[model samples]
Target: MEEDIAEIPHYKYYFATFKELEDKVDQIELLSDVIGVVTIVQDLEKSTLNSRITSCRNVTIKNVENKELQVTLWGHKTDLFDDNVLKTLEGPVVTIFTSVLVKKSLGKPRLSSTTSTLFFVNPNIPKVEDLKTRFQEDVKTIKFLPSAITTQSSLNEEKKENRKTLVKLLEIRPKSTKDMRFTVKAVIVDICEKDGWYYMACPNCMPPVSQADVSWWCQKDSFINKSPLAWYKLNTIISNQTGKMRMMIYGRVAEYLIKEPCIQLVTNHVNQDKRKFPQAIIDVIGKYKIFQIAFETKAIDNVAICKKVFDDETSEATNNRHRLSPPINPKTPDPKVSVNQR
Candidate 1:
């Protein structure tokens, strides 16, 4: 039996580049294999999906060309991470994820492990050694940009002393330079499709990349020849009785409102005119909800940014509570600014 096993052929791997996998994001039936240097591994987390709880972990990897991509491990795959060995390693760790399902989040192409997905950390292969050598030579220059979601969560929360109206929010200037948060009530008056629905961004830095003659150019990182990530940068015109304002919704927030991923929408409507808005986005033109907005004091083009959106149930409950509360005093300003709940 041992002699028979030794005579069997070794397993073969066919790895795909970041560009190749991104092009096949919408092909749900296709599976891909990827290999890169493990740059960041997040702590194990529990999340509910499909009405059931599951263990998941995110691992960020970069290829020899300095292109980064995120891969999520689900179920028992999360236990394959050996933290002790990773921490004690003197060199960069290279991993190969096979038979992964390519998916998109906020326009960025990511991989999710399927039932057949398998991974190897620091696998003994010539390609892995080549990746390790490249990483060692460029370790100091390989700084991954902080995720926008992470930065938004780290921002200081503002006290809900007053719910600002659309007009009031514009008039007030924050004292500090840091981002200031505010709660506001508004309705989606129109979808601003002038900038389209999404933009291609650098996978590592998250900066919007411009299309060069033959490759994508990122101002911070210069020319990156690999495939760029598509992130949701949907803009909408929101309004209240006080006034109207243009608010920017990014990434997951846009996903929450649209109930769809940007990549999927783009793929499904690839033949449609770019100027025309997709039906998924157009459906939210009349939604009335509460938005937690983040105002950047120094921003030139961006006036207001929506962080978290309250659902219909939460918005209605808050409205009811406000109507039942009596006024504190005739001289006191109205703490709650009411808007049409259509």
Candidate 2:
């Protein structure tokens, strides 16, 4: 059996540029093998199918030629780049994904990993190093930052455009979006983990960043920055009357949900215990909220898009809309402010 396994032919991978994938979107007739660096990692999709939960992540990769490609991975493959796991890559890296189907969804071209798809991350290969070098230079020129959610006005406009009708959390089913987004109403049940609710990200690309010997480094962007910027990235388990699942709230929405800017939160928790979360952030365990979602082809789940938190009280505090916005441009962290990069 061991010899038989070793005898199986390794599939050949053809490094591709996003330009080669443009016309191939929206149809499975053209399958591809592509390589690039992780620029953005969107939230996991909230769904369980085939008796197991499959989560999806929306990723943007910069190819060797400096072209960007959107790749979606569903199911267990999403774990390949989890916050802690990808750090093992130890520095900047690139991904080589094979046998993915290209399709267009939500106005963007999407490449999804199929059952036969296999992905190699930060592999020890010469071509991968070249790709990493190219990715590093690309980050220097591009604003590789956290993804921004649709603003209230834009979301309202999309609704006016009549994209899709709202649905309950329990009503979500496999293969529902047909490459469209979803909107649902739910309530917060509990926080998943409070310790790392906010992460220090590279000021360039906002992937969970870490400290290196001389400067901070971003694994996804494949480069090192002078300092790190703290960003709000939360994963909480929420529910409707019928069902519950984990969802992600990021950047601006996270500030709105937590009611605290990430800059302050990180300042307060720098030397604190890792197991405890601030009571302020913990107080929203029972609030009702509305959300918009996009399909995660990898997890076969959906990522929460637009969010509006509702409170029971009729007070002015309850009526205030979220005022925080992601910076129009990435800002360098103040040199005086201490960043806990462990």
Candidate 3:
């Protein structure tokens, strides 16, 4: 019985990363044709809309070539096996069911001891390679693919263009100051956002200010009767093999992208209307059509670079600085006492 089980043909496996998997995915025979061991497990509790109904455990598996494949596990298997199976099982295989694509994509994979689709543990599996040459060649092919942006620009120049929209995330870095305005452009690996505003500072003195009651204060004067205004500052950092550069953009140009009404809300006190605060910020930030998707990049998208003003505002050190003076002489401590007592 054991020998017959070992002879049975299981799902064919593909050894590739998620990117590679996406590329050659069409060549895959069927959803049922793919299988591999779970290599990584992700917790999806925080982000999803239906947090209650779904299991948080999602698995990522590495095939023979060390390519990662994300799998969602669900049903009875959620209760049967703990996450420790990933560490303990030398080989845990899963069989794919093509007809089950709808639900399979929704939940993580479940393991069953008897089912061919599920392998509790199997010792026999191939070693993963460092890199797949075939994947590298395919990437090279994609690199030469024609861009629609290029085509659109040519058509516009010839006056033969129709109404068409192009959506792209462009990173702009200040190359140099021209006519008192900074010139910038998109560069690879440099962070960029489409429609976000930087905390506005005064152009004359470049001072940052919080919302004042029904007014805004500059260094010497208060601009009263002015609708609460938040200045949008375009923040960008450009880095390449040569070096890195940081730029802060201001004036009417920044106002055009961020808009006036949204900026007013950021600078105003909306305490009584607490719900509007978060949504207002999101609306202002989201207007930037091209956003760097990664969280790390997004965090610094609209940051303001300003100088610290006062010495008292400095951060204090936690370590003790005082040192006691040592005794003048080892035997001279008996000034107040008798020589016999010493």
Deviation from native of the Cα of residue 273 in model 1, angstroms: 3.1
Give the winner by TM-score.
1
Sort the predicted structures by TM-score, highest score first: 1, 2, 3
Number of clashing pairs per prediction, in order = 1, 12, 13
> Which residue pairs in candidate 1 have backbone atoms (N, alpha carbon, C) closer than 3 angstroms, thus clashing?
107-230
What alpha-carbon RMSD in Å does predicted model 1 have with respect to the real structure?
12.5
lDDT of 1: 0.73
Best by lDDT: 1
Candidate 2 wrong stretches, greater than 4 Å: 1-179, 300-342
lDDT of each: 0.73, 0.61, 0.34
TM-score of 2: 0.41
* Candidate 1 TM-score versus the reference: 0.51
Per residue, candidate 1 scores C-alpha lDDT tens digits across 226-333 of 677667887788887899988988876887788887778878975556557877887776667778787776775447888776554445554443332334675654
